[model samples]
Target chain A: MEGVLSGAIGVLAASGIWLVLRPRTFQVIVGLCLLSYAVNLFIFATGRLVLGAPPIMPRGGFIDPTAYADPLPQALVLTAIVISFATTALFLVVLIASRGLTGTDHVDAQEREP
Target chain B: MTPGPEHLIIAPILIPFFAGALMLIYDERQRSAKLAISLGAVMAMLLVGVELLMRSKGSALTGFNDIGFYLLGDRGAPFGIVLVIDRLSAMMLVLTALLALPALIYAAAGWHRQGQHFHSLFQFLLMGLNGAFLTGDLFNLFVFFEVLLAASYGLLLHGGGQLRVRGGLHYIAINLTGSLLFLVGVSMVYAASGTLNMAHLSLMVPMLPEPQRVMLHAGAAIMGLAFLIKAGIWPLSFWLPTAYMAGAAPVAAMFAIMTKVGVYVLLRLALLIFGAGAGASAGFGAEVLIAGGMATVVFGFLGVLASQGLGRMAAHLVLVSSGTVLAATGFVLAGGPVQILAAALFYLLSSTLATSALFLLIEPMGREEGGIAALLALTADAYGLDEREENRQPEVGLAIPGSLTVLGICFAACLIVLAGLPPLSGFIGKLGLLQALVASGSATGPMAWIFVAILILSGFATLTGLVRVGIQTFWASDGAPPRVLALELAPVVGLIGLLVFLTIKADVTLGYMNDTADALLRPSIYAQGVLGAPRAEDASP
Candidate 1:
């Protein structure tokens, strides 16, 4: 599970970087969304990936290290997801408005001249 | 009895919050009432800030527990969120509220009506800034960073010009990237430490095993990078000037403090988590910070010299402020005296005030370009004609054609303060920093000399850019004098007046700043206060 999750994160991050570097604003937005996903996965993996363990405290109400997954990273990641969603929405609104105004997909608001 | 004065820590964050929500219910035409409410909320915040500052200065500010940290609803630490009211955070709250009062008043002079929800956005922005300063956990810091960034976005786009839209897009993009980095950094630190509370992390950072320590350091480095980006430090700061230039004048003024938010976080977190007691990791990135900071100052100077527009020049001046503060903080971290930190904090206040004043002054100064040019031409002719005693243009003019004298005087005050000229707060701040540096006994180093040179040279660069723009806009232009309103002029003049007051009362401010600096250097006290942990150095003292 750790290997698989790490692999997915690596690939997402790589592709996101490539896309974000693209000239089109839409591509950059998509890339940012992808990068955010990669980051989420990265943050999740930082907790030391667990295959079967749930982070819930036992009925006895004591934590045993290396027994269950860490719950703090999960909480942090959840918050990050919500904020990224709102931010992405805001980004898209700006993206559309920018495209309408600039008539170019370039992030700099100017088209490349050859 | 109702949680005592500790509860006031949260009021600065809440007053603006509730007011913002309430303002949303009022329609656009209800300008008078909304303005009144905005003023009341800000004034109330300023009052609370004053109270908090005084209390923090009193005996209550001892040990982290009694002084700064208050778990929300008394939620136990390492789990529930916390609000800290150290001299540092209290000072930040006071500064933010102070800036908000002037900025909001200036906005009401017609900038408020330029949008759908200016008042709400301003209040929300205040809530975010105050909360960011008060938060005691990394996760909550991230949350407030988002909150403030969100509010900044709304406020930036409020006026709805094409330039604003473009700038807003770039601003949002760059900040989102920073936010992403911040999240990743926080999560990594959480994973390494198994906790998100700053106080807890402080206790645990020194004890991390070798490999985890490495990871934590990497995470912190990334997080610090994100903050530097926001702070407009050299390389990551390219987005700041254009975006800020495009911002409405009042928003830009308020944003002068916003950049300091990054500096505040850096100083707060770096000193807290990685100060002397961090065992193996004390002064981990001191060299890099100093180098990067010096580079920022150089770039900022170049930017100031290069900028042609008044707006962009003001924005570059903010960069200069950030660079100077960053480099000075670096010196302190690199084992300079506590006095340097105090001086830097003083410089921080003066520059913030001066920068905000400059941003507010820009509009009125630009407003009269046409009339200013004509006046300049006439004044020049008088000078050229060997003015007889009767033909002298009043060095200080009476009320005529929209008080060019007031605008010019305010403009001059901003220049003197920003340029670190004597007799004003800016000069006093720079003098304090220089005196502290020399007294630190490290003034012999090449780096110290270079830093000194950068400080003095950056001021010169800023003065050149501003004076050039001043000549073009206020003197060279041939247009009619722009109509400056009393509402707008009042805030600009009031902001400069505040700077003058700060100059006059430098000793008291410096004393508080030194206390704040002392608190920062002793992280064990803060850690023990927050987490009730045995002090790492408990055996020594």
Candidate 2:
């Protein structure tokens, strides 16, 4: 589980950074979402992965570090996901406005020389 | 020492929040009601700031949360979200009110009517700033960062233009990237230590094993990058000047303190977690700060000289202020005397006020008022009469339009303050820093000498820039005087008056700042306050 998750994290971050550097505004916004997802997953992984164990505490509450996944990181990641959603929506709005006003889809709102 | 009333600590954050959301019911055309709400909220914020500042000093640190500063209401730092108020934060709160009052007042004069939702955005921005200053945990800090950024976005776009929208896009993208880095950094710290409570993190950080310590250090470096970018350090500072230039004058004025927020957080964390107590990690990033700070100062100097526009000049001054504070703090962490910290705080207060005043002054002076066109017509007439060198009139008897005298006085005062000349608070602040640096008996050291050199050069550079602009706009320009409104001019004068007051009462103000710095340097009181030490009495019910 750890192996697959870490591998996916690397790929996602790489692709996200790759797209973020592109000239087009739409691509940049999409890249931002991908990057945020990658960050969210990375934060989730920090709590340590444990399958088949409830994150909620047992009544007595003295589990070993390796027992259950840490719930705090999961909660933090949830908040992050929500914030990114809002920001992504904001970015899309800005994208349309800029394209309309400047008459270009480029991030700089100007066409590049061939 | 018992914690003061709960309302004092949280009101600054809460009043603006609810007031802003409440304002939504009012129609855009109902300007009077919205203005009343914003004014009432800002006035209440100033009162709360004064009350908090009075209570913060000499008071034992107390919080209810184990995870944050909200521990006093049965929610200690380990689990509850805490809101903290120490001398540093309280000073910051008061400073925010000081800047916001003028900026908001100036906006009400005319800028607010330019766009939709100005009052709401301004108030929410206040809430976010106050919350960020008071918050104790890493996660909530992130939340406040987003809050302020969101409000600022709307505010920047309030007076819509193509340039403003373009600026909004760049500012948003850069901050979002910074936020991602902040989250990664916070997670790394949490992964290394089990808690997000600041004091706890401080306690746990030094004891981590070698490998985990490396990871924590990396996290800190990345987090520091986000802050430095926000603080307008060189190379990372490119977005800053444009944002200020493109933003409306009032928004730009309020933003004078936003960079300082970055500096404030860095200062707090450096002292708490990575001070002399941190053993191997002591002064981890101080050298980087000093070098980067020096570069930023030079960049600002050149930018000031290159600027043809008043707003652009004001933007570079912001960079210069940040560079000075950054370098000053870097001195202390790099093993200079702790007195330098007090000096830095003094400088921080004066420079923020002066820069905000300068930005406000820009709005009144930059208005074209048909002055240049009128002057051009005069020149044509004069040429028609006779062709000769130096035939232009100093004053065309154009009845030097409305409020030019008052505006000129305010502009001169801001220039004096920014240029770090004597008989003003700016000079006093710089003197304090220099005295502290030299008195440490390290005058012979290269670092101290280099710092002094940059300090003197930056002041000269600023003086040159301001004087040239003042002459061009106020004296040389033949345009009709821009009609300065009382609402706008009054705030600028009021801010400059506060600086004069600070100058005359330097002893008392410097003493207070000295004590604040002493408190910050010694973190034991802070730890005890938050942890609610067993031997001490409970701060409150």
Candidate 3:
């Protein structure tokens, strides 16, 4: 499960990097979204996969200290998701402003020197 | 009695957010009210900050528990968010306030005339910068960073000149990438360690596996990259001088404080999370930092040599200073507690003083530019005044206290101090750093020698260029170019006064720095302070 998840994360990262390098403004935004997703997944996988459960600690049941999944990563991911959302919104607003002001969506629209 | 320091930590972030919200409705044209509101908030922050520092210094900040929305709370009360006011963080908050006050004052002086909603954005930026410093949780740090960046976007583009717009775009683009990675890194740390509580992460970081550990390192590296881009370390620093050059002097000064926030976080992570086995061996990003810092210093010197006048030269010098601090901290990290702490503290104090002075200097330098240019132009029209006046512009306009040469000399002396010359705080910092490096026993081989060579070379280069600037501007006989005005002298005097203050209190300040360092080296104290002493069950193997 870890391998597959991290593999998917790798693909997301590559695609994100490629898109980020593109000249289009929208592409950069898309790239940022993709990279964020990849990063979140990568972090999630680092908790050492627990097949039987999400990190909720079972009570009144056998307390297998080893079996209890770590809840910290989940908590961290939740916050990361929210931050990424805000960042995306910020990017959208800035992208629109740049377009309105410069009349171009290309990243290098303002570049003059070769 | 009063709620503990942990709760007070929230005020630094919360007060500004509340005040900034209030400022949004503030009349766009009511410059005075905006100034009052911002200044009022800053003073309040300073007061609260000093209180927190005093409290935290005495003992643990004590974490938060159940207090929902009130500005203050306890450190151990673990629910919504915990704000820990450790010595390291407390010091950073004080530094931020110091930089913020002047930058705001500079802005108040008429910089806003060229921009819109200046106070609103400035307030928001303050909120972000403060929040980043005070946050005890990793995710919250990311949130504050975004807040700060969002505010910066507005300020960077506030004036809307073509050059500014271009620089703003690049600045925003690079940081957005950084933000994305920052999110990822925090998430990874959470996954590996199962906690975003910085203190908890400190305990868990050393226990992770190889592949997982490497991934964590990568996350840290990526996060470091974001900060590096922000801090204006060499290679990644390309955007800094350009963006800074385009902004008004006051805005640039405020932004100078922004990069140090990145450096602060970088230092925090290196000391707290990445100091051990896999993390240390992975080199997470220390080598890059060390190399980049040296490069930044070299690049800054070269830029200064190649540049024409004061403003641009000062901008490049800031980049150099940023690198010097980063490099010094990197070297400091290689040594043990006592030496590293002393060195880091000294360097931080001197760096802040030098950087602050340079920022203030820009305002006068800008004024002088016009005066000096006009003088030279007049001399050309005169055909042949005194040869000195003909060859160099003389004091033409105002009655400056010293010759442009003397003023230039003072500025050069300041830079020499910045580059770590003896008898000044800069030298003390550099000397302490060298001693730490040597004592670390890590300085004997090739890497150490290379690092030393870079330090010495960068030092000499900075001195040579700065002295040359002094000679050209002040020493060279120029027909009296322009008498300096009070406005020009005021900021320079203020900066010099700060330098003098640092010099006089050097022993006391260095003592405090050492104390702070000792506190930082023992992560256990920080952990105990932020998180209630670990449970006996948790300690069980």
Per-residue lDDT tens digits for candidate 2, residues B271-377, read 88787677788878888888888788889988888898778999999998899888877777777787788888988999999999999988678777553234334
Query: Which candidate would rank higher by DockQ, 1 or 3?
Result: 1
Q: For residue A46, what is the lDDT in candidate 3?
A: 62
By lDDT, the best candidate is 1
TM-score (chain A only) for the predictions, listed in order: 0.89, 0.92, 0.87
What is the CA-based DockQ of model 1?
0.70
Count steric clashes of candidate 3: 26
Runs off by more than 4 Å, candidate 3: A1-11, A37-82, A85-106, A110-114, B1-6, B59-80, B209-212, B276-285, B368-413, B438-446, B471-492, B533-541
Query: Which runs of model 2 end up more than 4 angstroms from their true locations?
Result: A61-65, B1-4, B59-69, B369-402, B441-444, B533-541
lDDT of each: 0.82, 0.81, 0.68
Residue B110 deviation, candidate 1, in Å?
0.6
Which fraction of the native contacts appears in each prediction?
0.73, 0.40, 0.40
Estimated TM-score per prediction? 0.92, 0.91, 0.81
- Accuracy of chain B in candidate 1 (TM-score): 0.90
